[model samples]
Target: MTFDAYDTWWWPYLFVLVAGWLASDIWRFIGVAIGGRLDEKSEGLVLARAVATALVAAVIGKLIVFPSGAVAETSLLVRIAAAAFGFGAYLASGKRVIAGIVVSEAILLTSMQLA
Candidate 1:
């Protein structure tokens, strides 16, 4: 089916909603279905966990090392310092993820304001 603006303005929105759901939610559903059966110590589970952690680390590393937009304008040293502060907060807060995120964001924003 061909989509034309004159045909319906809402078509594009509908298309994006359906496309995005299929692209992301399908995998989530499949993961839920399959993940339940996997043993915690199974190699596949271990690899999946490692891969997920690596992906998160890679994203964080990219943001720190090669930021874009306004963040890119910040000095690398300041960015590194903010990350260090966040990591320290995380460790000091008994590894609470939210605490680390909040502290890091506060430091980063405050540094930006000062800079």
Candidate 2:
């Protein structure tokens, strides 16, 4: 019955957040510092590239299939159409990601209104 009474759950949540941040960010900072000493075309870089690609794919797949907001409320077909429109724009505009994103968002908004 009080703001300061988070009780048993608070410590675990705090610990997880702090630990996750430290685990991820510490190595990320070290990577930046050690980047100049590392080879761009190394095996480690290749593994990192693969992991990054997989994560990106997972995020995009989630967005197109199982979003978690107003976007989640929209139909899959609508989302796909919007994405396709945006991608087409990107291709037409010399692969400019920002332009593609803007056009795609506009398409999604207009389609949602029409629906």
Candidate 3:
């Protein structure tokens, strides 16, 4: 006899949850095991950090330049202004990430309300 998992709604969710957890958690555990032996200041680690930072910057740039969903409804000017002001807030607040996010979100919402 063959069992059809999709016949039950919970089975799909449970399958996805377990599969996703296993997929990511395995790598996380492996990283924990290996990361301890790596030097934080090594060239490889430095390059990894740089690449991660660049990816974040690229994502932000993409959202600002070619957003989707609600963000796409806002004008390019508003998006650019929000990002610029957010960066200014980050700098003015001594590089606190939360401050940058709060300021950026505030700018976006306020401008959306006004427009």
Return the top candidate by lDDT: 3
Regions more than 4 Å wrong, model 2: 1-19, 32-36
* Residue-by-residue lDDT tens digits, candidate 3, 1-115: 1235468767766776677678669878989888657678999889988998998999989989999998898999988998899999999999999898999899899988988
**All candidates' lDDT scores?**
0.84, 0.84, 0.86
TM-score (all chains, Cα) for each model: 0.66, 0.74, 0.66
RMSDs, each prediction?
Answer: 5.2, 5.0, 5.7
Native-to-model Cα distance after best TM-score fit, residue 50 in candidate 3, in Å:
1.2
User: How many angstroms is residue 101 displaced in model 3 relative to the true structure, after the best TM-score fit?
Assistant: 2.8
lDDT of 2 by residue, 1-115 (tens): 3434466768666766676677789988998887767787999889999998998999998879888878877889988988889999999999899989999899889878987
Residue pairs clashing, model 3: none
- TM-score for model 1? 0.66
lDDT of 1 by residue, 7-102 (tens): 787887777777766777987898888765656899988997899899899998998989999899788888888888888989999998888889
Best by TM-score: 2
